[model samples]
Target: MTEPTRLGGFLRKSGAFLVVGGAAFVVDAVAFNLLAFGIDGHGPLYDMPLVAKVIAIVVATVVTYVGNRYWTFGTRALQRKFSRYVIFVALNIAAIGIQLGCLAFSRYVLGFEGILADNIAGTFIGQALATAFRFVTYDRWVFPDDHESSARTAIESA
Candidate 1:
């Protein structure tokens, strides 16, 4: 019997997703910092955190979504159902909440300190958690085109 291809494909997809996400995160973080400091010119508590965060999330999400859709899952998943992308967007909204909550908590309660530092630290922690959630949801629901189950069923029946 041939080995399952899903495992290999999943690993490759997830790895690419991670790499793209890393780049996106850096881009968003830098933009957030620049806007918060250069444009508004305020510290962490001066009422610019949310704005910066929103921008960061938007920028990063766009990159993450495109990369995941194209490189991770490939075009096959896209050809399946268009509504799936909508569902994926909804799930990302939840992830945004998680990311924001962590950032706020670390900044307010833990006194994470500094605009850049607080955002960086909080987002790192938050995004880590959120990414895990995204993986499961995407694997089971979002893409839903791995075709691993039927292959197993056929193998077993044979």
Candidate 2:
């Protein structure tokens, strides 16, 4: 591809990624709010914040993984890749820890009104770092190796 064409392709792919990422963020936020606070039909899981958060994060991660694999990276579903995805998610858990830890520290230690602000702040930071890690791993390791220009090429070689 020409320089301009390659740049355009990159930008097009990037736009799709932004859309998928935005949707994933919405999924995470909505799930967290509903599950942790018991908003929207869920019961007030006030005492079980940890459990609620875990569940919510898992749900959000599923959506993100599916979107990224299918749409962003244009990869088909593969069982082996799912195993790699698990490890990817394990790393994401660290980011989740950072997010909730920030929320707890800011709300309890710093005595903020609510951690919504700090939680959002922390999550933003964590997501950026974690997503970069995810992208690198997904590209270099998770998805199948494609020595050829097309997946068909790799498949035929295999």
Candidate 3:
């Protein structure tokens, strides 16, 4: 068996990340639209778009964490579960800020508060920026590669 080249490994990791992110994005989009726009343009949090975004982000964060942990970066290492979760949440909060900023810009700065505008600004543009940020930060900090240590730790535990 041969190890993959650097670019190959990166492509593989990024492909998995994209798959996980796409699923999480769906979750976020559905939750946000439901809360902010509702069935017929009047959701429970229609007046509170930011709050709606926060709620949606929370839900989507959970999904992304699980997917990334168990699938995207699963084989790296499984150390410091609680601390990793904390870091993950913190990074996600920063991502949420990115999303909220986009939404706010559309609603306040640009004065385009329609559903289409909100989706384009927050769900699409904001998500793209945040996703890129997450991929970099998560790879560098949250899920550092420690394959040898992880295997040794597993053997020791067993």
Candidate 4:
């Protein structure tokens, strides 16, 4: 492919990844808020922010795995890629650790607490860093497509 064609293909695939990631982000944010704050009373089990972050991350990981497998990466052979998917899940757990560490640092070390601090630490800072890690890993490890040129071809022809 030409340089321009390759660039366009990369952008198109990136756009797809962003769309899937954005949807998962919404799910994570909403679930985190509900779990951390509750509706009209104290939140459910584990009022702690880290616990809430864990729950939110679990929920969002499911959404992200499914979206990334089917939509973003287009890996339809679940049986074949099950082990790779597990590795992907493991990486996400590490990403959650990064997020939780940020939240903990802000809340404990920095002596800041509550919703805003948690959001700033976990959502913006941690997630941004984790996102770069995820994109690289998802491309290089999890979705190891043998016919990667097919995806590029479709995008380039569009």
Candidate 5:
């Protein structure tokens, strides 16, 4: 029956974020693999891994948006639906860039063209970086706390 400390709240929120992100990651990975490297090592978009990644990210973005909106940051003040979705998509585009950069570096720069390498570079490393970016940006901008929400409201009304 005690108030949760700030750190405790953050930890709980982070846990929920991780769960949502994990589900999104699974969707992204499965889609990317299926499109880029099928069961027989030749997927539909096998020749174009970047395109495959973009498509996968798009699908996973939908999952993340829904999960984060209703589960991860459910208690946060709601913003205008259109505006929130636009901002969410913009931030996701940036995160996709992070993922793409890692994948591109592994595929083009490092001359890595294997499933394992792609997963390590794009799925693991890139996701880690992008997840950190998303957590901060989502908390601060996409789903602001009460104070920030009020300030945003003032700015919108001005």
Candidate 6:
């Protein structure tokens, strides 16, 4: 592929990641809301929003992994990619910690105890920063489309 074509492909992949991430975010947010505030009354995790967030993240991450592997990164080598997937999950957990930290700080330390503050600290600002970090790290480390590796594989088989 030409350089411009390669760039275009990368941009398209990035856009797809953003779309998938948005969907996953919705999943995370909905699950959190439901867990923290049940339909009829307060849920089991009502007082423990951080724990609820963890559960929500795990659910959303399963959705995200499938979307990223099949749609965004387009890796068909499932067996080989499994290790990378594990690493990605680990990194994602760390990213979730960032959001949790922000919420904890705002809610506990700063004494900004409100749903609006929680959303602002954990969902909006934290997610934005974590997304930026994830995009770059995922492209480079988690799911690199390594031309060198492909070339080497072909050479070895030949």
What residue runs in model 3 are displaced by over 4 Å at the alpha carbon?
1-4, 148-158
How well is each residue in 1-158 modelled by candidate 6, as lDDT tens digits? 69999899889888988988898888887887788767754767878978987888788878777888789888423336667867897889888988788878887899875556766887777777777777888777787766656777999999
Each prediction's RMSD over C-alphas, in Å, is: 3.6, 4.8, 4.2, 5.3, 3.5, 3.1
TM-scores of all predicted structures: 0.77, 0.67, 0.88, 0.83, 0.88, 0.83
Assess candidate 3 and give its TM-score to the true structure.
0.88
Q: Which parts of model 6 have CA positions greater than 4 angstroms off?
A: 75-82, 146-148, 152-158
Name the 10 consecutive residues with the lowest summed lDDT in model 3. 1-10
* Worst 10 contiguous positions by lDDT, candidate 5: 1-10
Count of clashing pairs, candidate 3: 0
- Candidate 1 residue lDDT tens string, 36-58: 66556663524667667777788
The parts of candidate 2 lying over 4 Å away from their true place are: 40-43, 75-83, 113-115, 122-125, 148-158
Worst 10 residues of 4 by lDDT: 73-82
TM-score of 4: 0.83
Worst 10 residues of 1 by lDDT: 37-46
What are the per-residue Cα lDDT tens digits for candidate 3 across 1-158? 24567678788889999999999899999999999999999899988899999999899998888888788889786676677778888898999999999999999999998689989999999999999999999997788777766777999999
Q: Which candidate number would show the highest lDDT if scored against the true structure?
A: 3
lDDT scores in order: 0.73, 0.61, 0.90, 0.78, 0.88, 0.79
Which prediction has more favorable TM-score, 1 or 3?
3
Error of 4 at 35 (Å): 0.8
